[model samples]
Target chain A: MKTNNGSSRAYSITSILILIILAILFLFPLYWILTGALKTPAAINSAVPQWWPQEFTLRNFEVLFSKRSAPLFEIGSLTGPIIPGAIRWLINTVFMAVLAMLLTCITASLAGYALAKKRFAGRVILFSLIVAAMALPKQVILIPLIKEMSALGLYDNLWAVILPTVGWPFGVFLMKQFAESIPGEMLEAARIDGAGELRTFITVVYPMIKPGVGALAIFTFISSWNDYFLQLIMLTSSSNLTISLGIATMQAENSTDYGLIMAGAALAAVPIIIVFLIFQKYFTKGITMGAVKG
Target chain B: MDKTLSPKLRRQENISGYLFLLPSLVFFLAFVVYPMVMCIWTSFTDANMNSNTADHFIFLDNYIELWKDPVFLKALVNTLIIVFVSVPIVCIFSLWVASVIHKMKEGPLSFFRIVFYLPVVTGSVAVTVVWKWMYNNYYGIFNYVLKSTGVIDKNINWLGDSKFALWCIIIILLTTSVGQPIVLYVSALSNVDHSLVEASQVDGATNTQVFWRICWPQIMPTTLYILVITTINSFQCFALIQLLTSGGPNYATETVMYYIYYTAFKLYRFGYGNAMGVILAIFIAILSAVQFRLAKEK
Candidate 1:
């Protein structure tokens, strides 16, 4: 708050300079992905790192797209028309992340509202369980999850990833935190106005907790999209790969093809980064609010 | 908190609460809770990919065997080293960055937050692949930059050498890890009781004194939350390992989480993997409890 003192001002300038440098260092990988994606094979393979690409081309994207092909999607006995496998993987990733986000928001909001406002038997126990489940190492659940998913025929399916993500309980925990700030009097007034439970939630609670949902939605999308561990285990086939998984698989095969891999990396990262940038305010609020009373 | 549960109210509340909770509970119980329970149960049995015979209960065997297995022991040690090394570094580093930037104008503040967060939003695959290239023996940026600057003579296989492999992974882990803690701490610093800060400043307290004495305690909960998450993340460090080293040249970077995947998937030792999973969960639970206890004391 105090900027008048010369020594303090100098200290602030030094810190800001350091911050700017660190910020650039943090941003370097992303800059690499975009530039590397566009760089020629020669530039990528050179002993000298290209701080910036000398020349850019879409050849990497061309190579990436031409690498493989798959059906866009599949039903029980039906499949969509053939397309670039990378596009299919992008479709799969989007589908998984979107479905997971929608389902988590819907379920977590309902459950979170209940945990926050309702007086019910075993509510404490249930709330406690949700918090504990949030902390449980996914490695624990994932081992049996593989078996359970295979048993339920969800293995190698997008639902295998989506269902577990929906069930993860972090969204519920976050939403409950947001919901707790809603005044009880407001809920009581809505009930007195003859609003049904669902109606009261839709009319009153939803508007207030939208920011929390925004936060959860953005994160759930990013996490599920980047959930390579789950995707690697649950999804095995080439055609069923998520974008990130597809890129990783591509790298494993063409290890030294840095341009192609960087293209794939760019494809995997750009849209989510855009989404994060758009909703970052809500995302920050959700993160801070969720940790406030913890 | 003020609401009282009369019998009539309790019944109505029960119905409505359970109704609201139904959809989430269905998925939670079926996927998360069931798998967790199954993980514990299977850990006590000799389950494998071979399904000719049913899994038989062999109580306490997997836990005992894990202690005797050197690889498992090594993985456990590696996991702990990552957690112990990365958690404090992340917390302190993030706190520093957050404190520095919290006072910045909105434009620059958002820019810093977004920058620090870019690696995370970029997803692990992209980040890992690029880092892999950077650490490559021949054309990697690290080797090129270092050799030119006279840091070392010959090219070092960053991810291949046991000496530098684990630390390299930890450095990448540190970058990804700081994003959230920084975000959390920035918000926490901004939200600190402003009056306390101003009062200390008026009393001629230095910036460092205010940060350490007033601001730090106020942000303790945020710090603790970040601590718990960073610990869990460091514990669950898998994708980077799976993509980068696959536990590498000499099992140098083998973490417990990676080992579990290797045991269950590649080797098909499902029971043993589940046991390791159970142990991992226990370790996390214990550490979180300890963190909460330590935080409570302050």
Candidate 2:
């Protein structure tokens, strides 16, 4: 009995220690980011990190907001000055990502409902094609995609990025799984009660699969927001660039402006962070429920 | 009235379904399907961005030369190293953390879960910038801690050195992105049959034995899913490499995706890049098929 008690105590201690270590590991970088954004360039470059800012000021924000300094778009030369360009890029990114999400969720829910509930011709083939599509990397189509977009006069537009990702096969797959868990009887009953397919979807089905849609929305938003490769290839002008492209270009042009870069980064992180916090309950439930089917 | 119009209405329903899916299908076929066909088509040609006015056929020349291209070969090698090394480390760490959280009750455990998952919500720009600061060669937090602790004699150039660059990137990738897998593992563990665990304990099975014998088998499918997705993700890894290093230190960290971007956009070698892209697609598809087959077999 004493041995059992000792072992239990030991187990508890070990668990606590492990948890602390993991927590620190996970949280420290975030702490660093927050502090780095707040600190001055001199303080940041100091041999010993102030741990806290020596003199906190909104100078970085001021630098970001000042538009009279330079045009953000003209810094393509091998060596030239750059404007902050971060704010405009942020607006473009968020707009595209949100629009993409809305389009994806609507289309995905429809396709998912069809795949999960309806019996149709080429059902097996269509489902197989969607699954196979998940494995097809974006690289394979990128070159031709560029040509096609350019031909359509959509190149260097925000729509180019938004449209390509809106038809995400995995998003459809996830929704299909969630829709499958809904009883077929409910749909049948709705049909019997003179409800059209669209009506049933809007009324009974969408509400039931809100968590799945929410999860998909959260993920799609993040990936689209974080996306660099497509945005990089598509957007030529700095003003048209997404936040990710803006930051990358800024880093490339001015490696010395670490303070401004980190500040821009913090700004970029704020919107998504706010979205996550607001939708966290749904996000957590959605992720857990969505994982099994995923 | 119901009987008279039922068949016609059913046909209308089917039509509406197809109509509803039209936008997505059109986009997919045009952007995804058409481009895929074009990629394969271009691979068989000597099509250059500058020489688009002329047609030069080069059947299998790109593939033949790709095997010999040193940079291409190096990128392939680096990609494999990253996928294999990083995925398993991420899985193990996420599982460990998930199990710890599973043992704890809801209050604090839930808080930690949210905290860990915050990185997933935070945009890549923020994560990259944070790591760029943390992994700084001079006066960055990581080096600062290491030097202060006397762990290292001097600051190290993390994203600059060929020796440590990829590994540094991999570490950052694993640490910040453990959130998704942790969520998966937690859900998987929670859904596991508690009765089986109780039965094992009553039969005098130790926690270690139960975990090895029971939980391991149960979570195998989830693990497999993670493996497949992680492999796909590793292949798709671009932003971090692009942001931090730009495939620098003599292209030591160049993954195929990054290489594809460079070749098509920077080098004006669309044909060659498209061919390489097709090859990458085939590799991923074959691997994904194999993974699904293996998972289904069990």
Best by lDDT: 1
- Cα deviation at A255, candidate 2, in Å, is 0.8
TM-scores for all candidates: the values are 0.97, 0.91
What TM-score does model 1 achieve against the real structure? 0.97
* Candidates, DockQ: 0.79, 0.52
Identify the runs in model 1 with alpha carbons over 4 angstroms from their true place: A1-4, B1-9
Stretches > 4 Å off in candidate 2: A1-5, A67-84, A288-294, B1-13, B51-55, B289-298
Question: For residues B26-101, what per-residue lDDT tens digits would candidate 2 score against the true structure?
Answer: 7677777788788899988877776348747889999998899998888888888888888888788888888878
Give fnat for candidate 2.
0.60
- As for candidate 2, its clashing pairs are none
**Candidate 1: deviation at residue A14, Å?**
1.7
lDDT tens readout by residue for model 1, B1-298: 4356567767888999999999999999998999999999999999998768899999999999999999999999999999999999999899989989988899989999989988888999999999999999987999999999999999999999999999999999999989889989988888889999999889988888988999989889888899999999999999899999999878999999999999999999999999999999999999999999999999
What TM-score between 0 and 1 does chain B of candidate 1 receive?
Answer: 0.96
Kept native contacts, as fractions per model, are 0.90, 0.60
